[model samples]
Target chain A: MHNRSGLLEACLLILLKENKSYGYNLMNDLHKFGFEEDSLNISVIYRNLRSMEKRGLITSSWAESDQGPRKRVYEITADGEQDLKNWIWMLKNRKSQIETIIEKYENLK
Target chain B: MHNRSGLLEACLLILLKENKSYGYNLMNDLHKFGFEEDSLNISVIYRNLRSMEKRGLITSSWAESDQGPRKRVYEITADGEQDLKNWIWMLKNRKSQIETIIEKYENLK
Candidate 1:
């Protein structure tokens, strides 16, 4: 699979910014946001969360869950908010470029 | 750098569909089409051409040039045209998805 880890990271930032969340719930939220279960798994989400934490984009803390085990909850840092803004800018720029290419392809026909 | 090789291949197919072209000229055409020269180089063009040929998406033939060494010109095969269509479809789908994500982000603000 061509990993869309960049897009995944962007989505993660968006979710964390709204409210601090743990892994399992975040995965569910991703599905609600249009990510298919097959397209992403818990491992990928965890890896990205860890990477983002290392990059200072987010921070994590363990919280006691009412059930089974303690959960690691993630929250967006100030850096994460800035990165999300950058991602939005880049995505908008790329959308315009793709639009141009699509227009060119249509005109050729 | 994140390799946008897939997008590069789509652009190459579009150019080939218009008319057969060699690597150097194709690079220039890409620049005119909004791909920055720094974003793509001759080697990347040649690499994609070769890979596309391997996949039967394009075919190449050496043509003698009066001013320089013989150049390999590339043309889109029937499969290349089909692949180009697929690429456009995928790009359109991705554009919509990106738009959805952007909208979600804006709504959160």
Candidate 2:
């Protein structure tokens, strides 16, 4: 199987692609999909969010709050949308490759 | 696209998935596909490798080297092979998602 980083990052992007969210929100949402494990590190989420923001794939704004601290809400940008499109293309391309490998493995088995 | 981490990590896994290779080899090979940029940080490779190994998706061993330190070569484990399957599955599912987003973006454009 592939490493967890891509899946986790892709998932968070997909989530923000749908709507704006905060770091904790992403953590909670992703947790439902088996992202709560050690492989899905909490720091990874923050790191990806910042990295994506720097790439112009996502943009974030701080929401003023009375309690705790200001929450950073991230929204997908236009470039982010296109980026997601490319990611989708990568996924489609990997599909064929995986099929080939699976067939080969089955044959070997 | 969907945050550089996933693409980079996935690309790395896809590399090792082909055959066992060392960190530098994986980094250099991935660099061939636009991974040399800042978004594809070098440390990220080792981090994902460790994470993947921890998940039981990959296995690694130190190979004796003549020129330098022992080079760590990693191979996909049985579970890792299965994990790659799941990763491929995730990619396939994202295809439809990206298509829908593209059509929407085009309509807005």
Q: Which candidate is the best by DockQ?
A: 1
Task: Summarize candidate 2's per-residue lDDT along A1-109 as a digit string, tens digits.
Answer: 3333244555676778667899977888775444325545678689889988998989999998778899999998889878766665565454444444444434433
Q: What root-mean-square deviation over C-alphas does model 2 reach?
A: 8.4
As a TM-score, model 1 comes out at 0.88
Which 10 residues in a row give candidate 2 chain A its minimum summed lDDT? A100-109
RMSD of each: 3.3, 8.4
Give the TM-scores of the predictions, in the order they appear. 0.88, 0.50
Off by over 4 Å in 2: A1-109, B1-6, B32-36
Q: Please provide, for model 1 over A1-109, each residue's C-alpha lDDT reduced to its tens digit, 9 standing for 90 to 100.
A: 2324256788889889899998888898887566655876789789889989999999999999998899999999999999999988878876887888799899998
Q: Compute the lDDT of residue A70 as modeled in candidate 2.
A: 92
Q: What TM-score applies to chain A of candidate 2?
A: 0.82
Can you write out model 2's per-residue Cα lDDT over B1-109, one digit (the tens) per residue? 2333244445556667777887877877765444324545568778888988898878899899989889989987788766666655555444444444344434443
- Colliding pairs, model 2: A1-B80, A1-B83, A1-B84, A6-B6
What are the lDDT figures for the candidates, one per model?
0.83, 0.66
- TM-score of the first chain in candidate 1 relative to the native first chain: 0.86
Predicted complex 1: CAPRI docking category: medium
